[model samples]
Target: MAMIDLTRGLRSHPVRPPASGIARRRSFWERIHLDPWLLGMLLLLMLAGLVVLYSASGQHLQVPIAQGVRFGVALTVMLVLAQFTPATFQRWAFPAYLAGVLMLVAVELIGDMGMGAQRWLVIPGVIRFQPSELMKLAMPMMVASYLCRRELPPRVRDLAVCGLLIGLPVVLIAKQPDLGTSLLVATAGVFVVLLAGLTWRFIAILALLATAALPLLWMNLHNYQRQRVLTFLDPNSDPLGSGWNIIQSTTAIGSGGLLGKGWLQGTQSQLEFLPERHTDFIVAVLGEEFGLVGMLAFLMLYLVIVMRGIVMAGGAQNTFGRLLAGSIILTFFIYVFVNVGMVSGILPVVGVPLPLVSFGGTSSVTLMAGFGILMAIHTHRRLLPR
Candidate 1:
């Protein structure tokens, strides 16, 4: 009777499956350290971007085809990086950051000047790329690596060191006169600091300092940079010059109404009324052709990606993973917000592109690589002993 009672008790609770069995049950994506949800959303966004780019480029098949190639390359890079563990990324973070900073310094000394900014480094026929874009990923990785080793709610001394790490790259990038990338890099590093359980009092103090430094920042701006701010305040002041982009972009978006003019049918783009319709202002092209419904649908996709990122960050097993993932996703949100706001004429035209939707390779590749890190953080978590 005693033996029977014990057997009944043992049978009452089911046993957990062996870890090997769980490992075998992982899907192909899990085995490869990829997040299907995040990957699927990114692919969908890239496909949509190609479709819009086709129209924005006046039905140029070659343009979308080239962009497709870029997406393929970016996805490959993402997949390869995702295979790495978070610890691997933590190990490489400082060296990658140091290399990136060295490249930025190299750019300052001998960079290819184009469109009034010395932001690109050209190595003859080998490759031409922007170091500022590299800093976007490095910034978060570095700050997260730095803080994860220290205590949470970092002490003032630690914060100061983190600040110096962040400020160096920011100052270098800003010297490139690429305000958009500089601010993005700065935001990336700041996100990590904020995610490290920063006290609100410290945050407030930093905010006050930033506000006080605005005048100094303003004084250092180039004439064109200042002009962008003035134009944001009153675009109509230079109707045919600096204001043309905003004026035309707003017109494109407004004309789309609730159900857009239909794909490849926007007058603002097809008739050449809109400038930069394929790049920074691509959202205007989307709004003009897809209308309010399309815009909402597109934004809903972005919202889902951001939500998934938040979920992944919450699930991270360590501080480094959490901080890196959180900062990447938040910076991605800023990318969308700033581009859309600039196109809508609410913010200064800072040349930020809509993530995955803009017609460019460097930004797209950098963004996908960041997402790869997020996947590594989320998918490479170790199972607990049962």
Candidate 2:
């Protein structure tokens, strides 16, 4: 009767259809909405990363095959994670944050150190993963859960608590001597705080304090870390030593000219002249082989992902969902920005991979897991609890 009244005389028109069992079945499936465009952008980036990895690896069989296997595994992980909602995530956020912190502490006590950093926990007959990677998701979840119960802007005391939460992980990661991951995690946490409407004055003060501490930070940094900062200022100062990576990267990028040197034909990569060809410096390989056009396409894909994330954040119905979505988006931006900045010689080389493109299973899997959480957040934002 209500439907008849709603439709009024239109119900008598030919457009009206009879409700049947088949219609009900169709409705059920139609109600289950998925964001295909965002998912497509994600898949495209991963594919590009895989293709680039194949190109960048000097020993194609060793790096490319392992990367392909890991990419498949990461896809499975992403699928599993995509099934859960943000509220389900909220229940475990604190525990996940605590566990991640404990793992960081454990690394200091009993971790397998490699390349001057105790960043991985190698379990027998299992995966060797970085605990710091978990912070990419957990930190945002932890911060979002805290900020959701408050007003738009938080109080000073609330800000202090946020600072402490951010500081603990940053200090632990930095002590791992992994300055890059630590910076990314710090940015992830702080991004949520800023999105929660922290005051402009506080942000200004924070920047000023960071600048003020640079001299002090410089004094305490490890020699190599310090060298990176100085080299960033002027790569030519030590072109054959600490500055070699950036110089090669810039030269490769410049030598690509308008189009490129062609696939599998980069002199810098093929001749074994470029350092870290398949990892931190992979972008240089890409620049040399695919030129500015390919670089711009890559950036466009990244921009699509970023914009889609912002849409998810805006579409979110609750504070936690909004903040979590925004945090992930911001963290993604930092990853791209740092990689490009370092490769372009504007920032120091601090060992950050170019998202899915680098030949690192651990990082690739972790990033996919984070994206899965984002999908879950976005998909369940407006759904009613069954």
Candidate 3:
């Protein structure tokens, strides 16, 4: 039903006179101040996430309430970011990107280490920052700013410059041993470049090159990374080792069958077999407890958000807005996909988290920030000439 409404909204002719009149007539809460449809969808998903997180996190009451507070904070950030114009974003794109790169450097030089990775930097009494998360937002903005400067469908020279912009941060993040972030950062930049009209032939060539480089990439992967791929291929071979996560997560999902084991009744999570049940593997918890029906309903909500994003991208008034919005939205979908795929044993596990649903402070805030930019693009469409 959400998809159907979005489809109809897309099909309707967008005349500015009525749109502006409607905007003027809207209540303070009804304006693009917050996209009504998107906000409604987010509220539903976040509420559901809270419920799932409660169960996933050992059914603790404080867990969902604390996440609700984080959701409130993240929502406030989104609202503040939404107030900015696309022009403001475009104006600041390069600086934001540059700052991200510099911070990633800082993280490398003096970042705190945790869980065997140098991905965080705590400022004594201040925030514990993750620059890679910032790159997830900045990379697309950088590529959009770069491509928006040139003609539609960039030249080879243009592509090379964009490649440098993308590769630098990706390499930096990967050096921090964060393959998940590196992949997402690269994906965000590449999507901007692709949407900005890099030709299909060039994309195909890049794909071929990447495929050819697979063996080299595999050779360069960390020992655990290679073990993950091997475990993906044959999880049973090392049931007590690297494959434990995949085997357990898949069991939770598969056993849920259709309707699920019922909320809070999941043996895998309640009994403590699933790792990261509140973060990357939360979907398995959802699958195990709520079953297929619940999962599909949640997915429908997710697709609604994606659809609205695509619509916003299509409606953007400028090249930069379009490219940035589209890249952010697609990158969001990919993030969710990577998380789910890894947990379900279809892909090698990386550090990716399920977007809004995953229990992580950094990723949840970053994703909401991107959506804030999306709202800015959609709502700030110039009033049609009277």
Candidate 4:
């Protein structure tokens, strides 16, 4: 009876051959279509950004038609980026980081000057773009990938190497005088390290070392940089010059009260009392127009998005998946915090843009790229179910 049962099982079916060429490629496409929530967020953010951009760009755009065009371009780029998988990104991670660093190196050498900083690269009739923006994503991926191979709870030596990798681009970016982005990249790298189970001892040591470096870093600051630090301590000291932005932003925020001045009718924004209304200070616009209720809702959206990323990272099947998702999410938190801090009087003005709310083609596209990677990690994590 056992022999007859074994024969029947063996004869039941024959295994098929592996997929090859076009058939294999078709299977990949089918899987991506099965999951479109990733694409959904990109669409949502793009639409929201478009509305905010038009409202923010009102001063500059008489008709605001160009704002729509920019969003259209950004949306197309985001959709194209969404199609890529984490594995596809893994293959190109090192090369992309290398290229990004080289571009920064080139920017130091022959880049165009802008806003008193040498950070833009212009190619003939094409366009100008910031290399540092690429670092926003590349630095995290490169550092996380390097440390992912190590055993959990990395050693001091391992952390030192990681710091060096992080510091190189950060130093270059700071040299460009773009302190905001430099800080963001560092935050992203450090978040990945912390998530990898860094001990409190290492965290304490890092705090001490950072404190020790303050004087040396202080000497390296540009004059404007020095002014920002001073203004942060006492915006009242220079209420009309270096501190004008913060003071005005504060008034706009305070005047909002409970319900705010109403949308597009913000006296500060309409009367042009607020500086950078559409960009770094958009929070002020939201606060002035929509009040605390709007601010709370916005905060909740950020919280939900960040928590979702944490969930995805925790559930990731492997080290790379976990690190990638965690780093992106934390960097996003930095963007929100820094932007809000700058508008408020808490943090120094470092020129960090409010994530989806601020206006800029490069930033919007870069943010979408990071979000796409989060999708990749989340989707892949579910497949492995770790």
Candidate 5:
């Protein structure tokens, strides 16, 4: 035979198309791991947020610009995270969770103080970040990874171990006096547990125990934390102090009837009646400027995104992926629910931002990164078999 059979050789060793041709076929954005539906939702939310922020900031040109910059940075993080495969996330899951705990410990040792809470760690001349935010993402991953390794309908021991894993970070965060984040972090882990097939009997027992311990828990709360609970009961109790924000926010929202007073015409925001109009209470501005119509539209968009996220979770290739994606979606809805409920005078103000609509770079980035993990679960090739 000849050294090579031309047709057989060519058939056995196929050549890839030219690099230039391949490059021309797909742009960087096209190659990135992102769901177009989710991306569209995010972009629309940002646009709505910026429009509201502009009016909320009294039409200050720079405010929206700054928010836009934060969005761009967060978007970059999401896209980069998307490039990672689910296997990579799985491999890194425990390590990331451990690192988050170590960071929480570091925060306890040398965290910075701001707004009367030790929630952030800021170097004298370097970066500042919140360990709790890291926990928000890490908690679910750790729980999912551990649970997936065990049998379905985990035994008591598995549940105990899961509780320990969750409680450790919660205690650390609560010690930081950030009740909001501690609660959220715990919920994130718990969501994974429930979705992992934890029995309902245990859930009900826990609920009963929690109810029985409410008085004790109340006593354990810090003065301000206790005040927030009481304030939720009666805003008029401290209207000039803790309650002023809630009172003002409700007024702003209620005043935005049918079609609102027209854009940039909200007396509550423009006249400076609502506090934190650009951040936690931005939804109040939306309610004031766009009226009921605007609020409903925004809610619809948020619901769709939440549903899509849940759908992705159910579609995950493996158990870990399912638990993680589902928890993230549940936690996201919790964020939105808590913020809106607080502003609407039903829930206590927990210092939660309105998810993607709030003017918080840290929260925004953390959320987008979580979505990255979600996209990774959905887009990555089948890793572990079902």
Candidate 6:
């Protein structure tokens, strides 16, 4: 009987061949909690950014070096975060959200002011960063976690609660007068709610309400904020004053015709006519140096990244994973759109930096961490009963 049972077990589970070298290599990456395709694309994009940064910074080596170091730190944070499971993120969502909100409140009370905005919190000789950046991740996490346990196509009560959750931080950040980050945080939370099966009617009604509230919102804008809107409408109205940035940006991009003027050869950038060349307006540098062809190539790469993220979101094993991943990627798309639109003079300059391509520390780290969460959701999936 024992021999017969052993034979039956062997028949039920046949022996398999050993994994090939390629399979082993693939498994090694998965074991370390990394996604090869996503990582590969990100590295390629960052390399291109460094090349553009070198030219944009007047051929300065230090600029690219500093950005490279920040990239390293961001990548390390991503890998560390990727080691955790989706369940861990879900469990910590509420507490993280609460802590982030508290920090935003603290920023309101005693945050350091910089360049005309109270957006940073500094612990003397320790750390200085934006609480709004933290909410960029925390908002989606909290919303996704909240919605996963409830019924799909959420009820009015759930939607109201979610709206309240989203609105609190938005109001705080807007008070800090960082309109770009406030809108970004709001978009992050809203994406999660929308992904949880929001109805088309609710979306339309919300749009109507937002349209109606625009005038009231306009009334409360700061003087500079109002100037940005007016400038967007007609940059030529004040070409040498508040309109200088958009004018120069458009000049740089338009000058970079079919093949561009060549790397490090952009008159607008190299001659110092362009403003913020290394940060918010860096895309214009790429456009000037590499031409329309280069811009399209860069955008194609970005599109691939976005599509890959969407595929990961769809494949996620749980609702929380799907919602969080979808929101993060969609918010990232909004970042790219807003920055490019602002640079091209179609939208107001709200100080949004191009994702992964812009020169900045906090935003880079936040974005990489979000991708890390995505990798976690993808790699940690298991074959569980439905």
RMSD of 2: 3.7
Q: List ranges where model 2 is wrong by over 4 Å.
A: 1-34, 383-386
Best candidate, TM-score = 6
Ranking by TM-score: 6, 1, 3, 2, 5, 4
- lDDT tens digits, residue span 1-386, model 6: 33334444565565664589988988899899888999999999999999999998999899999999999999999999999999999998999999999999999999999988899999999999998999999999999999999999899999999999999999999999999999999999999999999789989998999999999999989999999999999999999999999999999999999889999999999999999999999989999989999999988998999999999889899999999999999998899889999998889999999988888989999999999999999999975532
lDDT of 2 by residue, 1-386 (tens): 44555554766655655599877765543344345677678778878887778778865776777888988998788777877878888888899999999999998889888977788998989877899999988898898898887777998888889999999998899998899999889999999999998778988998999999999988878888998998999989989998888999999988887788988889988887889988999889889999998888898889888898888778887889889888888788788889988998888888889988888888888888877777777777554432
lDDT of 4 by residue, 289-377 (tens): 78888788777777777777677667767787788788988888889988998898899999998887787778877876787677666
Scored by CA lDDT, what does every candidate get?
0.93, 0.84, 0.88, 0.78, 0.88, 0.93
Off by over 4 Å in 3: 1-32
Tens digit of per-residue lDDT, candidate 1, span 1-386: 33334454565566554577555656667888888788899999999999999999989899999999999999988999999999999999999999999999999999999998899999888999998999999989999999999999999999999999999999998888899999999999999999999888889999999999999999999899999999999999999999999999999999999999999899999999999999999999999999999999999999999999999999999999999999999999999999999999889999899999889999999999999999999999875533
Off by over 4 Å in 6: 1-13
| Candidate number with the higher TM-score (3 or 4) | 3
lDDT of 5 by residue, 1-386 (tens): 22234334465565565578556544443467677788889899889888888998889999889889999999999989988877777788899999999989998998988988888888778788898999999999898889999998888899899999999999999988988899999999999999988677888997898799899978888999999889999999988999999999999999999788889999989999899998889989999889999999999999999999998888997898899999999999999999999999889998889988878789999999999889888777443422
Q: Give the Cα RMSD of candidate 5.
A: 5.4
Candidate 3 or 6, higher lDDT? 6
Badly placed stretches (over 4 Å) of model 5 are: 1-30, 383-386
Please give the distance, in angstroms, between residue 25's alpha carbon in candidate 6 and its true position after superposition: 1.5
lDDT of 3: 0.88
Q: Model 5 compared with the native: what TM-score? A: 0.90
